[model samples]
Target: MDMAQRETWTSRVGFIFAAVGSAVGLGNIWSFPFQTASNGGAAFLVVYLLAVFLIGFPTMLIEFVIGRRSKQNAVSAFSELGYGNWTFAGVIGVFASFITLSFYSVVGGWVLNYIVGSVTGGYLGDASTFFGSVSSGTVAVAAHAVFMAITIAIVAGGVADGIERATKFMIPAILVLLAGLAVWGSTLSGASAGYAYYLSPDFGVIATNFTSIVPSAMGQAFFTLSLGFGVMVAYASYLGRDDSLPGDSAIIVVLNTIVALLAGFAVFPILAATDALTGSTGAGTAFVALAGAFGQLPAGRIIGFVFFVVLLFAALSSSISLLEAPASYVVDSYDTERWKVAVGVGVVAFLLGIVPAYGYVGLFNDFVFNILLPIAVLFIALFAGWIYGGEAVDELGRGTSLGRGAMTAWLWWVRVVVPIVVAYTLWLGVTNFYAGLVNGAYF
Candidate 1:
C-alpha cells in the first residue's frame, strides 16, 4: 500500500483500545503478578512503577513520534525519516516481535486448552498433570497452531476492520471480567493474607538484591506494556497527527498498571484461600495452582471457565500485535497483500513455536525476555534519544500543546537518561543469562 493509501485508525478511541489491547495481555495477568510476587513482592512493584514512568513512558512516546511522523511500519519508519543505518533498530524490533510470538503463541495455546479444560473439568483431577499433558507434545503443537491461525485471521482483516474492531470488544471484556473476578476474590477467606503478601513491601529484600530486582522490574515493565518490541511503533503508525501522544501514552500505562494490580487481586486471594500459594509463580501459577484452586471452589468450573476465557482474550490481543510487527514490515517493504503476509508469518511462527510447545518453553522464554528484548529496547532508546533527537521532539509536539520547554525536557530525558538506564539493564540481562547458563538454570 502506498503512503497515502495506507490504512489509518478510524477513530482515536479505536486506536487507544487497540494499543491498550496490545499492552494488556498475559504479561499483565500472567507475568506481572508472578514476577512481582517472586521478586520481593511490593519492593518489585515499586521499581516496576518507576520504570514504567521513567523508562517505558518516554520510550513509548519516542516510538509514537517515530511512527506517526514517518507514517510507515517500524522498519521503514527510520529510513523514511532519512536515518539509513538506524533502521537496524527497527529490524531488531521486528525480529523480537517474531521471536516473542513464537513462544507466546505456545503459551496462548496453553490458555486455549485451559478454556476447554475448564468446561470439561479436565484439569480438576490433577492440575499439574493436565497442564503437563497439554503444555507439550502433539496436543501442545496442535493447540499452538490453532492459536496462531486465529491471530493470523485477525491480522489479515487489516487494522481498522480487524484489529481495532476486535480490541474494542476484547479490551472492555477483559477489564469487566477481571473486575468481577477481583471483587469475588476479595470475599475469599484468606483474602487479607493474600493482600498482605502482595501489597506489603519487604524493604530488606530490595536492599539485599537491588541489582537483580531492578533488572527484573525493568523487564516486567517492558513486557507488560508491550514495549521493547515494534508492536507499539507499528500500532502508532496507524495513528494520525491529531492524537496526543502523551495523553494516549499516559492512559495506556495507567490502565495497564491497573489491570496488573487487578490480576493480583483476583489471583492471590484465591491461592491463599485454597492454600495453593506455594509454588504459585511462573507458568505454574496459572495452570497448576490456580486451576487446582478453582477445582476447590463452590462454582469451580464456572469460575475457571470465565477466567481462562479472559486469559484467552488477553493472549489473542497481544499475539496479534506481535504478528503485526513483522506483517507490517513485510507489507511495507515488499508491498505484499496483508492476508498473504499474515498466512506466511503465521506458518513460520507455528513452526518456530513447536520447539517450545514440545517442552522447551524455559529456553525460549529466557532468550526473549533476558536477551532479545533488552537489546531491542536499548537500541530504541539510543535511536530516539540520540540519532533522531530534535526530530523526535518536533514530532512529539505536533499533536499535543506542550511548550518547547517540555518537549526539550522530554528529548533530553530520552537522549541521556533512557539510554544510560537501558544500557545498564541490558548489561545486567546479559550477565544474568550467562549466570543462568553457568548454573544450568534453563535446563
Candidate 2:
C-alpha cells in the first residue's frame, strides 16, 4: 500500500476501457430499458439523456478531479486534499458502493441463471414463473454468492492485472454480442413500433407526468454512468498526471451511452415483436419478457445463450468497480493486503445480499438508487463546487486539454446547476419513498 507501489492503469486506453466497463453494466442493459418502459418510454429517454450531459458528466468530472488530485481512495481523498471534514461525502460514497453491490450481485446471479437456462431451455415455457423460482430461493442465494466470489477474485488481482485486463476483454465482447443482437432485433416483424416507442417522445406524457418522470430519469442517468458512488473516483485515483481527464471522461460517457442505446435497440424490438412490451416494466423484464422473446425466436437457444453471456460480462464489469470502491477505501485506509480485503468485502456483501436474493430486490433497489444515490451525488457536488472549488478546477485542468473557460464553466455547473437539480430530484425521491411507506407499497 505504499504510495509509489500503488498500481496505475498500464495505459490510457486500458483506463478508459475499465471506466466504460464500470459505466456500461446492468444499469444500462437491465435497469435502463425497464426504467424507460415504465416511465413513459421516449419521454424518459429524452430526460435521461439530458441528465447524463447536464448532471452526470459534470459530477463525474468532480470525482475524477478529486481522485487524481488525491491519489487515494474516495474516503481518504478528501483528507489528502486538506478537507477532512468533507470526508463525510466520501463515506456516503463508500457506503453507496457497498450497498449498491449487495443487491447488484443478486441481479448478476440472475444473469448467471439465465446463461445456463438459455442452454437448457429452462426459462422457455413460462419465463415469469421461471424468474420467480430462480429469483429468490436458495438457488438465488447460491448464485449471488458465486457472483460475488467471481467479483472478489477479479478485484483481488489488483488494478492493472485484474480490473484493467478483465475489462479490456469483457467490454469488446459485450459490444460485439450486443451489436449482433441489435442487428437481429431490427429484422423482427414489429420492430418499428419498438423503435417508435424508444425513440419518439410523447410530449404529452412528459407534460402530465413531469414529477414522476424526472426523478426516475435522473436516477437512471446517474446509475447507468456509475456516478454518485465514487466508483469513478476510485478508478481515477490510478490515473497519471499525463492522462487527459476531459478526453477520457467524454469517451467514457459517449461509449457508455452508445452501449445503452444499442441495448434499447436490441431489447425493445424483441419485446414488440413478441407482444411482450407490456411486461418490460420491472426488474424481471430481462429475465422474463426478453427471455420469453428469445424462447420464441429462431435458433433461440444459441441466441439466448449469447445474450446472457453479454449480460454476465456487463454485470461483472460493473460489479468489480462497485466492490473496488469500498475495497480500495479499506486498502488505502488500513494498508491491508488487497486480496485479503477483497475477500472480506466479498463475504460481507454476499451475506448482506441475502435479503435481496430472497425477493426484497425492489426495496433495496429503491433505497439505493432513488434515495442513497442522489444524496451521495449531492454531497459530491457541494464539495467539488464549494469546498474544493478552485482546486478542483486546477485538478481537472492539470492533465487535460480543457482551457480555463471550459473548466470554469464546468466548475460553475457543478456549483450551481448540479446541486439544484440533484436536490430537487432527491426531494422527489424522498417524497415518493414516504408515500410508498404510508401506503405500504414498497413491501
Candidate 3:
C-alpha cells in the first residue's frame, strides 16, 4: 500500500539497455580477460557459466523482489517490507555503494585517460615503457578527478535526464565499438593463437584451479551485473507491481550475460593476435597488454579512442547506478531533496574515493570484486530466501507461468545452497587477503 514508486522507463528496450550498460563495464572488458587467462580460459568459462545460472539468476530475482515489493529504495524498501532489523540491510546498501564507487571511479578515470591518449596517438610506441609512463602520480590523479567530476555532474542533474540519456549513448557505443574491435582483431596475423588461448579447454587446470576459481568466478558474476547489495533493489524501486518482477529479472539477466560474453569476444582476440596475451598476467596487465594491442593496430589511435570512450561511458553508466543506490535511499525515505542528495553523496563518495585513487587501485579493485561483492550477494540471497520468505516467490511469480514455476525452485536453491557456497568463498577470500599482507604476495 505504499505510494512511492518512481516512474520507470518508457519502453522495455530502454530499460534493458540501461541494465546491460550497468553490467557490461570493466568487469567484462578488463577484468574478464585477465580472469579467463589466469583460470584456464575455457575451463573457467564453463564453471563461470554454471555459476551464473545456478547462483546469479536466482539472486537477481531476489533483489528485484525486495525492490518491487516495498516500492522504495534500499533502506526504505527494507523497512517498508516489514520493520526492525531488516532496515539495516538497506543502510548496508549505502555503505557498499560508497566502497564500490570509490575504486570504480579510479578505474573509470583510467578508461578516460586511455580514450584521450588513443586519440592522441600516445600508445603508438613500445607498450611496456609507455604503460609505465601512464600510471599514477599525475596522470592517474588528473584523470581520476575528471572522471569523478563527470559522475558527480551527472548525478547532480537528476536521474531521468542525466542517467537515462547518458546510458542510451554509452551502451550502444560500447557494443558497436567492441564488436568492431573483435572483427578487426580476428583478421590480425596471429589472431588464431589468441583465440586458441582464449577458447581452448584445459580440464586439468580447472581441476587444480577450481578451489580458487569458485570465489573469483562467483564474485565476477555478481559484481559485473551489480547484483547482491540492493542495486537491483534500488532500480526496482522505480517500478510498479503491475509489472512482473520475475519476468523483468529474466530479461535483465539474459541481456547482462550477453554483454559479458560479447566483451570476451571483443578483447581476447586482439590480445592473442598482438602477442599481448601474456601482458595481462601481471599488475599492469590491463595497461600493458591493452595499450600494446592498440599500439600495434594500423590506426591504433582511432581504435583506442573508440575503445576507451566506450569504457569511460560504461564506467559512468555503472557508477551512476552505484551512486543512486544511496541517493535513492536519502531522497525517497527521508524526503531529502534530489539536489541535496546528489551533492551530499557525491562530495562524500569523492572524498572516500581518494583512498583508492592512487597506488592502491588494483588491490582495492580486487578486494571489491573478490570480497565485498560476494558478501553483499550472500545477504541478498538470504533476504529473498528467509526474510521475504514465501512472499518472494509470490511477489516474483505474479505475472507469467514461467515466472511462477521458476521462482519456486530458485527460492529453494538460494535458501539452502547458494549461501553455504558464498560463505565458504568469502572465508577463502578474506583468509587469502590477510595471507597476502603477511607474506608480501601481490597477486
What is the RMSD, in Å, between candidate 3 and the native fold over all Cα?
A: 2.3
> In candidate 1, what are the lDDT values of residues 120-147, reduced to their tens digit?
9999989989998999899999999999
- Top of the candidates by TM-score: 2
Which sections of candidate 1 miss by over 4 Å?
A: 278-280
Best by lDDT: 2
How many angstroms is residue 340 displaced in model 3 relative to the true structure, after the best TM-score fit? 2.5
In model 1, what lDDT does residue 163 have?
Answer: 98
> For model 2, how does the per-residue alpha-carbon lDDT over 1-443 read when each residue is reduced to its tens digit?
68998889999999999999999999899888878888888988999999998898888898999999999989999999999989999899889889989999999999999988988899999888899988998999999989999999999999999999999999999999999999999999999999999999998999999888888888888888998788999999999998888889999999999999999999999889988775436667667888888889888888889988999999999999999999999998888999999999999999999988987877787787779899999999999898888989888888777789999999999999999999999999988878867897656
Error of 3 at 162 (Å): 2.0
Question: Which parts of model 2 are misplaced by more than 4 Å?
Answer: none
Collision count for each candidate, in order: 0, 0, 1
Kindly report which residue stretches of model 3 are placed more than 4 angstroms away from their true locations once superposed: 1-7, 279-283
True-vs-predicted CA distance for residue 339, candidate 3, Å: 2.5
Candidates ranked, most accurate by lDDT first = 2, 1, 3
Residue pairs in clash, model 2: none
The TM-score obtained by model 1 is 0.98
Model 1 root mean square deviation, Cα atoms: 1.2
